[model samples]
Target: MEKFPQMGGELHKIFGSPESPFKTVSDNILQYTCGKRAECIELRRKLLEPKDAHLAKLLTGIPPSSTALFEERLLAEFVRAHPSTVRPKPRNPPRLPPPASVQPFPSTQPRRERDPALQVQEHKGSWHYCFPIQAQGHQEQPLTQQ
Candidate 1:
């Protein structure tokens, strides 16, 4: 389930970390020790691979890799060590001059005159204008013949 370092809780963090000591161990049969440290180093190398690193970074927000059993605790530790890089910062979408509003010509009233005088409307591939004439109250709006 919680396979990546950031996916699990404190108690579940049984994986090795990048900072874990990786000195060579004595190979003497009698003095030979476990390979956990070496495994830890290899795990770090794998996680640091550009693809895996990016994968780890992209998961939580977009989700939720690699070897199934490796403790994700190490990945979590990496995130812990470098908070900004691992976690995505919220980005402000470019402020658009609020969309050039296309308010349809009001059927009941005139649009206050602007420099353009008339508002243009695009239909299919052609342009047309709406001139609201208040005759008593309403008048038939015409579309220019194509």
Candidate 2:
């Protein structure tokens, strides 16, 4: 089989050829040794070539390469620029005054001639009354007859 130069020496030189220690080892070797470290450094250098250092500085406090930082800052600025909401004080219902006019009348009536003869005495917390017979000449007589 014929050996290809691009797939062999040229590509290996550009990506930092493997060290002398890995010279005797097979290319299919999976384990890490001194040669693997050199090749990894070369690859890292190539990958970082397109990065912008100034852009990195501008986004110092933000999460690494994430869009959430811009969105959060924009929302905060919008909230600060807008006017705050005003809430009206709570109002109490109006109180109604008492009625303007009131009429007064007496509850008790005067005793009549034909009314029952009742003798009242206060005993304990209640009033006790005695009823007398309605005689023709005994209308003005005392309730207790000794």
lDDT of the structure predicted as candidate 1 = 0.49
What does candidate 2's lDDT look like per residue over 41-132, in tens digits? 55653443324565334333332213332346644553354323122446985767434443232323355565456676555545555457
Best by lDDT: 1
Show pairs that collide, candidate 1. 4-72, 5-72, 5-76
Per-model clash counts, in order, read 3, 0
Model 1 C-alpha lDDT per residue in residues 73-111, reported as the tens digit of each score = 655765676566554546975754433355344643567
Q: Could you say which candidate leads in TM-score?
A: 1
For each candidate in turn, the TM-score is: 0.21, 0.16
**Candidate 1 Cα errors over 4 Å, as ranges:** 1-71, 95-146
lDDT of 2 at 50: 24
